[model samples]
Target: MSTPKMFNHKTQLILVALATVLITVFTLHANGYLRHSSEQDALYISEFSLIASVPGAQGLVSTKPADFIARCDGGYLVMDAAEKVSKNLTGVLVDQKNRLISCR
Candidate 1:
């Protein structure tokens, strides 16, 4: 003869509670509602200036915002408002006379 296995009531309640909490946490995280502070720090643009230029840049021949684009010496330039260009800028189209132009 074999005996049937059974879960104790307290154990069952604990398991249910744990599952509920886990599901709630998972749901919140999936929806971007719950995130660790460290995760927020990861939300960074590789190129601050390039990201800023997306909406402001019109076209290759089109003119850029005068305030955003500046003239350094020989050519035109695009500067980052956040002033985080050195490390963040991915690529440079032209670097003339300390001016930054073109970004990808």
Candidate 2:
């Protein structure tokens, strides 16, 4: 007796086509040819500490003048002042072209 064929010619062709498509996709991904969303620039800050005294100033203080200077220089600064005052103190200094000038 002869052995029966497990898959016919048409079924084998279909499987070959599907495998080809999968292989193409895998190859593209391996070669970094797949499209992806652009990533945003990341900002880095240095470590430093400063103290400031404001005369005739009332209410609260957000960030120290030194910390403000650091922030302007592309460095991150944290102030121990109240949140409200800190929010007010937070401001970005930009150039005429609207570009950040506080980069060290």
Best by lDDT: 2
Error of 1 at 69 (Å): 17
Q: Going through the candidates in order, what is the number of backbone clashes in each?
A: 0, 1
- Give each model a TM-score: 0.36, 0.36
User: What are the lDDT scores of the predictions, listed in order?
Assistant: 0.53, 0.54
- Writing each residue's lDDT as its tens digit, candidate 1 over 29-51 gives 99999867754344443332333
Model 2, 47-81: lDDT tens per residue?
A: 33333566875545456553333333335332232
**Regions of model 2 farther than 4 Å from truth:** 38-104
Runs of candidate 1 with Cα error greater than 4 angstroms are: 1-5, 39-86, 89-104
TM-score of 1: 0.36
Model 2, TM vs. native: 0.36
Q: In model 2, which range of ten residues has the least summed lDDT? A: 38-47
Our model 1 lands, by Cα RMSD against the true structure, at 13.5
Worst 10 residues of 1 by lDDT: 87-96
